[model samples]
Target chain A: MNSFQLEVNIMQIKVLYFARIKEAVNYSSEDVDLPEDIETITALKHWLSKRGEVWANLFSGKLVVRAAINHNLVDDLATFEDGDEVAFFPPVTGG
Target chain B: MIRVQTDDFDMAQVLDDLRKHNPKVGAIVSFVGLVRDINDSAEVTTLTLEHYPEMTQKALQAIVDQAKQRWDIIDAVVIHRVGTLLPTDQIVLVAISSAHRQAAFSACEFVMDYLKTQAPFWKKETNSQGARWVEAKASDDEAQARWTQ
Candidate 1:
């Protein structure tokens, strides 16, 4: 008898939406699982845009939204690991 | 010290606590921002402020730390208010205490300038024309850039 093992790579990340982004998405936060292919922020955004019409429109590169990873502002090219918290929102307008 | 709260702050009490043990401070400069009845050609009756809790605190602390590093100030305090606010309500306050008038004035202005742009707070205005989010001004960015250069 022969036995084989299959390996899989998955990453679970906490995603937060704030301000206008939250209002648009109608969600505050959720945990999402992404495949290994979605490693970077840009890839993740592209992947998330496929969720539905609202997601597609919001992440379609028209909105001037910003992103933060682990509570720190980061560029779209930033990469993430499992269990990281990512946030998206509009430009800050406070003092 | 830094604080982000929905409750209104007392400037006199805050100043008293800030200068309680600091006998070296000679000058205290402060700035208070308030909600206005009119903005951008609209009548603003109520303004609701929103923020990212963790990020907002971190950003405020970082701003104060930068001011401390740049100026020889004895101490500083930043109190920002969130939630629904009516016209004439206090929105933010920045106070800097220093040994001289110059440092206190400059640092206070510097902190306010940075806070306007760097902080992660957003304001939505409810006006006669309905509610809308306030846009970031280029003038604010320019004011902040002057410090970097």
Candidate 2:
């Protein structure tokens, strides 16, 4: 096994999908083992887009997705750590 | 106070509670958002509200905190209801109290404007045609922006 591939399962992060993004992806939340090179929010978006066509549209800016780390909003360049909780959703519409 | 729940809230009781807590308050401004029967040029029957549960409360508190810092408000109360709701159902209530009416009114508006654009809750309306997610408006962003200027 490639050493880099072996490191993949070591870091686990929780990803939450909300609202429209949840309906499109058919998942409310999931646990994803980070790929060795997927370290930042932008990198994670690009990597997840490769999953398939629907995933691509959801993450490739077709939907204006927002990200948050541990309940706080963060920009695309924000880095992730093991066990971090990340959320993605469209812009809010509540008052 | 920030609350997210499925139970319908009593606006009268909520305001009375605020008044009780701050006896010195001279003014209270409250805004109640209701599920409307018409939306986006369609006749709506029911509305569903969804949110990131953990983040929703945190975001609301942060908005209230910002309002507190920006105005001479005594306190803020925010209650948002989720799950299935019918037309005319109360969806949210934002109330602020202060020593003066000017402070109360301004802070109330500031909290509401920020909540419209910043809170994590999303609303979906079901009309005769079907259900659709409420789209974010450029006008909402503009509403939030005016506070800074």
Candidate 3:
């Protein structure tokens, strides 16, 4: 009966929070369980928003939040692979 | 060269190291960003700069590479400081060396302009009133747009 499973799926992704986002979340990083319905960066945010009020408030304004996948800036439409590193941060203010 | 560190940098030393044995460099242009005492009319007392480590290095390298591709500069150096800093402290440096002044000047400005808009660094200013994160201004975007084709 166990042989009926045809594939193994990644159950989690590494998530990083930086700068203001880090302060807001009160943690720098975490291992986020990849929800069965989450397939894209936008979906990932929607999943994270369910974590708590702080997360909901932070992700609710998606316009101000910027994302990077595997160290490169990415749009919401970007796809994520299992074990990929995803970072969420506010817009840069450095020179 | 692109560097991100918490220590202060010596401008003269960086400029000297840039042109070292290369006599082809006839002109050197540089710009330094300093921590100001006032921002958005707040009496800023201190400034803290934060960056995304590996991502910051990559972004800065990409910026300098773009400048090199667009200009005929001999070499460029970017040194940015992080962590806590006081007013009037040096925060960043952009220097370019070239056989002529125009190329060096243009490339140096180009790198700094891109750094302001594209680099993954965040600045928080602590004024007498309170601590606040600095907002990215539209003027910075306009400054970078001027160089685009």
- For lDDT, the strongest prediction is 2
Candidate 3 wrongly placed segments (more than 4 Å): A1-8
Winner of 2 and 3 under DockQ: 2
- Every candidate's lDDT: 0.88, 0.89, 0.87
Better candidate by DockQ, 1 or 3:
3
Model 3, C-alpha of B26: deviation from truth (Å): 1.5
Candidate 1's residue-wise lDDT over A1-95, tens digit each? 12322355778999998887899899899999888778777888889899898988888688777788888778899988899999888878887
lDDT of 2 at A23: 91
Tens-digit lDDT string for candidate 2 (B48-104): 999888888889999999988889999789999999999889999999889899998
With candidate 2 superimposed using the best TM-score fit, by how many Å does residue A15's alpha carbon deviate from the native?
Answer: 0.5
* Deviation from native of the Cα of residue A63 in model 1, angstroms: 1.9
lDDT of 2 at A65: 88
Q: Could you give the CAPRI-style class of model 2?
A: high
**Candidate 2 on A1-95: residue-level lDDT in tens?**
79876655666899999999899999899999876568789989988899999999999877788899999878899998999999999999886
CAPRI-style docking class of model 1 based on DockQ? medium
DockQ of each: 0.72, 0.83, 0.73
Worst 10 residues of 3 chain B by lDDT: B36-45
Q: Highest TM-score, which number?
A: 2
C-alpha lDDT of residue B145 in model 1: 99
* Predicted structure 3: clash tally: 0
